[model samples]
Target chain A: MNRFLKILFFALLVKPMVLLGLGLNVFFKAKLPKQGPAIVVANHNSHLDTLVLMSLYPLSQIHKIRPVAAADYFLKNKLLAWFSLNIIGIIPMQRKHIRDTSALFAQCHRALDDGDILLLFPEGSRGKPEQLSDLKRGVHHLIKSRKTLKVVPVMMHGLGKALPKGEMIFVPFNCDVVVGDAIPFNADAKCYIDSVSNALNQLLALCMTRQSVVKDDLE
Target chain B: MFNIPIHSFYMMTFVVILLITGSLIRWRLQVKNPQTDYLELKQRIQSWWWMIGILFGILLAPTTVSIIFFALLSFLALKEFFSIMPTRQADRRILLWAYLAIPLQYYWVATNWYGMFLIFIPIYVFLFLPMRAVFIGETKGFIRSLGTIHWAVMLSVLCVSHIAYLLQLPVKNEQAGALGLVLFLIFITQFNDVCQYIWGKTLGKHKIIPKVSPKKTWEGFIGGVITVTLISGFVAPYLTPLTMVQGFVAGTLIAISGFVGDVVISSVKRDLAIKDSGTLIPGHGGLLDRIDSLIYTAPLFFHFLYYLHY
Candidate 1:
C-alpha cells in the first residue's frame, strides 16, 4: 500500500512536472525504443538530452532505464547529487580512472543482467552538433561482456542546436531521435564490439546528414 | 453569503465584455498575419476556456476544495522551477527534502500558523538542510549544493506559501474570511495577465524590458493595472471588508507584483536555456508559464492583506 501510494504520489507530483519540463514529448508524433535490457546509445550534447530520452519512454519505464551520467558532474555538487540520483535515477560513472571504468562496466553488466535497460551516451561527455566524440571503451566493453543485451543505436538530432553546450538559453526548435535497428552480437567478443561501434557511427552519420527544418528554411 | 445574484451578474457581464473585445481584436489581427491566424485563434479559445473554468470553480467549489486546488497549482509551479535548474547527483537527497517541503508549508497555511510558514524555508529548512549534508561529511560540492537547495526552497515553497497564507485571513463573516481573499487575489492577478497580453498585442510599442521580456510593454502594464484596479474596486466590498480605493490599491499592487514575478521566472528560464518550464498545460508553455505572475504576486499580496488586517 505504501509503495502504491508512493507511485501514485510521484505520478501526481513529479511526472506532471517532468512532462511539463520535457514539453509533452509523448504527445509528439514520434517513435520510441521497443523493449528493455537494451543499450540506448545517443550523442550527448546538453543537460536537456537526458530529459529528451526520459520523455520518450513511458513514465513507468523511467526507473527501468538508468541514465549513465558522469560521476564527477552529478556528484560534484550536493543539491544536484540528490536530484540526479533520487529524482532522475541516474547511474554515475567515473570519467578519468581506468579502475573506475572497470567497476562501472561491472555495474552496467549487472544492471543488464538484471533485465534493466541502460541509457548510454557513447561520446562519454557532451559535445558539439553532429560531432561524434571518440567512442569511450565503456559502450564497447558493455556490448562485448553482455551476450544477451542488444545495442540500439539512437541518433538525437537538433538537441545540440536547441540547447547548445555552455549555454542556458534554448531556441525554440523541433528535435527528433531515430532509434535504428539493433546491432547483432556474435560469439567473437572483439568482432561484436567493432560491429557495435560501426553501427553507432552509421547512426550518427544519419543524424548529421538529415536535413533540419530550421536550417532548410533559413537557407 | 453576500449577494450571490449581483456577483454572478457582474461576473457574467465582465466575461462577455472581455470575450467580445478579445474576439474582435483577434479577428482584426488575423487579417494582418494570415500564417499565425490559427495559432492566435487557438490561444484565444484556450484562454477563454481557462477563464470560464476559473470563474465557475470560484462560484461552485467549497473554500477547502478551492484552497487545495491553489495549493496544487503552487506545487506544479514549484516543480517546474526545480526541473530547469541544474542539480548534481549528490543533491538528490536535498531535492527529496525540497519536494517534501511543499505539503508541510501548505499545511502550516491551512492550520493558520503564519509565524511558522513565514520562516520555515529561510530559517529552519536552511539550517537543517546543511546540517543534514554535514552529517554525511561529503563536503566536496557542499556550498554549491546548499545554495541550490536554499534557492529552490526559497523560490518554490516559501515564496508560494503566500497564496496559501491568504487562506488564513479573518473577514467579517466566516466563509468570506480566508477563501474569499485567495479568490480575490487570484482573480485580480490572472485577469491582469490576460488584460496585459491583450493590451500589449493591441497598442504595445514601448517595450517594458525588451531584453528580459520582449512581449511585456508599458502600454500593456498600464492597461492591465487599470482594468484589474477597476474590477477589484467594484468587487472588493462584496468579497471582503475593503473599500473601493483600497481594492484599487490592492489590484495595482497585484498587477505590478505579477509583472515582476513573470519577469523573474522568464530570467530563470533564460538562465536554464529552457523555453517553457514544462508542458503540462496545453496552450500554456509549462507550469511556470501558468504561475509565473503568481510567484511574486502571492507573497506581496499576502503581506499587503496581512498588514491591512483583513
Candidate 2:
C-alpha cells in the first residue's frame, strides 16, 4: 500500500505540478550529478520550496531524492504526515524536541547510510521571502559522521515569491534552481556552510541582475 | 442556436490581414535595422500566431470546443496566478475546491444558464471562499489570501468566461452573427494594445501614468483611442449589432478599457516587483498579461451589446 500510494502520489500529483503549479519556465542554473549520494543543501523559504526543488530532478530519479523536513511541522496532521512520509518519502527530523539531537542524527545518518540522496535546508527556518536568511550548521553535523558525504549547495530563486511563508495562496513566479559544484566535506563545519551560503548568494544576485538587464529591453 | 456569423469570417480575414501586415513590418525592420533587437518583435509575432491560431481554431470549431478551449485558458491563467499566491498547507484542499470552480463556471456558459452563470461566481463563490478558508482554521493572512484567491477566480474564470458566454447570445443573423461580436471584442482589445505601443514609441513625449505604467503616454493613449475609434467606424458595421454611432461608443469604451486593463496589470507586476506575469507566450509576458484587457472589456462589451440587441 505504501509503495502503491507513493507511486500514485508522485505520478499523479507531484509530477503534474511542474507544468501546472509553477505555470512558467523553470530554468536550472546548474544540474545535479546523477547516481550520487550527495547531501544537497538549499535555503528554506516557502512550504512550496521543497516541492519546487523536487521538481528540479527527473521524474525517474525523483524517487531517489528524499527531502529532510521538520517532522513536527509536516507531521502536525495525519494528511500532511501521510503526504510527507509516504508520498514524498521525506526523512523527518524533529523540530520541537530538537535539543535531543541523537535520534534526529540517527535518522539523518540512516538516510545517507542507505545510499539515499538527503536534501537539507541549512536556513533551519523560513527566511524573508526572496531573500536568504542566516545559514545554520545542521548540515555539517549530518555529514561529519560520514566519510564519503558529497555536499552540494543548491540555490532556489523565486519559490519564495511563488508561495511565501504565512500566505496560503501560491502566486505565479519564475523559479530558477542553481546547484553549485560538490564541495568535498572537509569536516570544517563553519567553512563548508559559509561557502555554500556564499555560492547561493552569488547565484541569486546574478539571476536578479541578469533578469532586469536582459528582460527589461522590451520595455 | 444562431447561424455561423458571416462577420466571424470577416473577423478571421481581418486577423489574417493583421498577421500579414505584422510579418511584412517585421521583415522591413529586420532588413532595415540589421543590428536592432528583433527578439521582442519575433516573440510578439510568434505569440500572435499561436494566440490567433488557437482563437480562430476554437472560434471556427464547434461551440463546445471553443468553450472548452477558453476554460482550459482560464485554468492556465489561474494556475499562473496561483504560483505567486502563498497558500497555507491547511487550505490546500480548499484551493482545490477553488480550482474546481473553473470548469463549473465554464459549464454554466456552455449550458447557457445565464442567471446562474452570472451569479455562481460573484455571489456563490465569493461567499463560499472566505467561509471555506475559515473552516480550514488557518487565520494568518486569511483575508488577504482569501481575497487573492477570490480575485484570481473572478479575473481568470468569471471575467474570462464572458467570452465563452458570447456563444450563447441569441442573434439569428447568419450574415453578421454573434461570434463576430466575440471576435470583434478580442480584435479591438489586442489591436488597441499594439497600436498604443507603436504610436507611443514613435510619438509619445509625455508620460500618461508614469508611476503605474511607465510605457503609457498621453500621446499614445489618444493616438490608440482615435485610431481604434476610426477603424471601428469601418469594421464595427458587421462585427457588432450596434449602429455606427453606437459602434464608435463601444470602440471608445473598449479602447479606454484596454488602457485600464494594461495599467491594472502593470500595477500588479509593479507591486509584486516582477517583470512579466509568466513566460507562457513568447512575446507576451504571460497568459494573464495577454488577456488583461479582455478581462475588463469582455463583460462590459457583452452587457452593452446584449442591451443593444434586446
Which candidate has the highest lDDT of all? 2
Interface RMSD for every prediction, one decimal? Answer: 12.4, 9.4
DockQ scores for all predicted structures: 0.06, 0.14
lDDT for residue B29 in candidate 2, whole number 0-100: 93
- Which digits, one per residue and each the tens of the lDDT, describe model 2 over residues A1-219? 776776676678866765666543543535565655778888787877777777667666777788988887889999989878887889888876768677767877776667778788888877666567788787777777775767777777666655768877764445656677777776687887778888878766434212311121112
**Cα-based lDDT at residue B233, candidate 2:** 65
Q: Taking the candidates one at a time, how many backbone clashes does each contain?
A: 26, 16
Residue B284 in candidate 2 has what lDDT?
A: 78
lDDT per residue as tens, model 1, A100-193: 6567677777777777778888777787553556666567666765666677776665555446677655443234455667777687656655
DockQ score of the complex predicted as candidate 1: 0.06
How well is each residue in B176-268 modelled by candidate 1, as lDDT tens digits? 554566567767878889899999999998999998888899999899888888888887766556677888888889888888888988887
> Which residue runs of candidate 2 sit more than 4 Å off their true CA positions?
A1-14, A21-25, A28-40, A44-188, A198-219, B1-6, B20-37, B85-96, B134-147, B176-178
| TM-scores of all predicted structures | 0.61, 0.73
Worst 10 residues of 2 chain B by lDDT: B83-92
Using TM-score as the measure, the top candidate is: 2
